[model samples]
Target: MFSGKLFLMFVATAMAQKDLSVDCGDDEWVTVRWRPELGFSQELDSSRALLGNCPPSRPASEDSLFFRVFLRDCGFIQQVTAGRVSYSNTLIYDPQPERAFISQPVQCVYDLSVGEEEPEETFSMEIMNPDFSGPAQSLRFRLGSSIPIRAVVEPRSRRPLRIYLESCEFATDANISRAAQVHPIIANAGCLMGSKAGNSSFLPRRRPDEMRLYLEAVWFAVGEQVFLHCVLEACAVQSLPVVRKACQFVPEHHRWVLLDDPSQSYACTCCDSSCLRTTDASVDGVSARKVLGPLVIVAEDPQGDASLDSQSSAGLSEAPVWLLVFAVVLVLMVCMSVLAVSYYLCFWRGGRLGYRPSRDLLTKY
Candidate 1:
């Protein structure tokens, strides 16, 4: 009986050593819970155990019953292969007395479904009417007219995500490159470069996952087909990062203004020069490329010239018929009088010449 009791105790010890549990079901984070054995609680140092070399986000909670850590805060290493994204880390714990370490590998796998059939399609960019009632069917626009553009991330994909326009350019083709004739509209991570000379701007956002850009219709060449290519990024952070901004150049003020937060216009001062990029890789974000258009900007109607031509034609028709006839007859009479005077002079000169010829003949005889 005594030997049996000792064997049961040994089995219980082995089970307690394997009590580490990791849950990767969370969308944004993985939860790690560690329960210490009955008497080893005081001997185990939770601080010594780490997730991917990152420490616990906070002290042990729930009356210290378990050590809880999040994958996002702990900086889990990410890997992508074969259209799959995986986050992985290991929890290692060492009890001071035993001098032996306990190891547990934790990982979370996410399938990348960028296929068109996927229901959780996240990102889209579209041109809308200025009022945003529906998609804009009129690709033809007039110069100085406002073109409303919107970029959106679906609500089902992720939460607490914000969208931003990283860079945008106008090109003649859908395939954009530096070698092509492209006009940079928005650059430096969302600064509206087109706003400097035009009235382009980023409209106030109505939602966190959506961004609206009001680009003024201006082009390098009139009647040329132009396409807008832009890079859209989604950030999971609650607030806008320093590098990500929606800046508009206010021609009236001669300064750049931040559309995300007008009070923090200081962040937009670099728009005139250059905006720095953020080196923080821990920020969860993804980018997508989008192209819109074959938009044509037409010149405004030449009403002034058209009206002048119409008036000149109408004036001639409006003149009295009798007055026109009288003018024509007057011109004809002037021509007839001049022709008769020339005829009489020619006849008299010929007669004089004949008389001089006869006088010469008589003198010779």
Candidate 2:
């Protein structure tokens, strides 16, 4: 009975061991296991930096490495209908190649119709890192609906490489009503806002219209991997009234932009009083003053010399046309005289000038 109990204990230990182990490249790779009570935790060994082979004196088991945890779609709404909301958590990792290693998925459903009562069921999971020898890992989460979801990293490193959240692709149609509030949070966190909306005004105009918020982050490295966090909130704005305001980023030099929907457009104009004006003459209800400058001087083409003024000036400044005609006639007269002299010498005086008569002429005589 004692031996049997020992064997059973060993079997339980083996089963528990199976649940935790580092999933290295190979099947036997050591995995660290955690109980549900541990929640989220991570540790890194400062001496064993992963950058170069500055080998640590510790054994392979003691070697520590830094790692990042990415919860894909951690906070997201899968579906919404009739005051019911459903969401699921997706795990993402920077060091761990497998998504399953992080934690099993948890799903939560909420029904607002329950009237301020607690959710009927809440699903949750804890994330933890057993290794304590590497750099601190970064964590990112999105709150509210406005984009670029806000992110926070623990034990912020001085001049630490900026970590990015990647994976989530923002859709233009996704809820952004929550995005406006979220932008202020992200800006306060020292991160630049990336946008799928080509124009900034595409962001929610009214504080309430902002709803859908998708978030991802990237390390400051120009082309580093970005981890996607979660879609925060999604809401409908189809019933909201369209609001038009001049886009704040539009340049002062540009003419008034034609807006198909006046309620949806806003003008961002220069502060100068003369820079912007609205006139009833415009097809749209707005018109701007036409800014005029000096006329540009264009160089005349040298080949276009056909002006009467040029012709008259050139005639008075140079030789007359009649002199040129007389010179040409005199040269023709000299050429004709020389030709007549040569012809007379060659044929008219052949007998007297020691030129022989042809035999044909002698036979004819």
Best by lDDT: 1
Local accuracy of candidate 1 as per-residue lDDT tens digits, 31-72: 566654435346445575555434454665542324344333
Misplaced by over 4 Å in model 2 are 1-73, 78-84, 93-103, 111-192, 195-365
Candidate 1 wrong stretches, greater than 4 Å: 1-81, 84-121, 301-365
lDDT of 2 by residue, 1-365 (tens): 00010111011122234323322111111222222212245333333221111112232233333321111111323443455433332222222323222232223343433343222211111111113222213222112212222222221222211112211222121232211111221110111133322222122222321212222222121122222222221112132232122222233433333122334333322221212222111111100111111111112321234455577777855767898899999999999999888878877977255687789999997
Residue pairs of candidate 1 with colliding backbone atoms: none
> Per-candidate TM vs. native?
0.50, 0.21
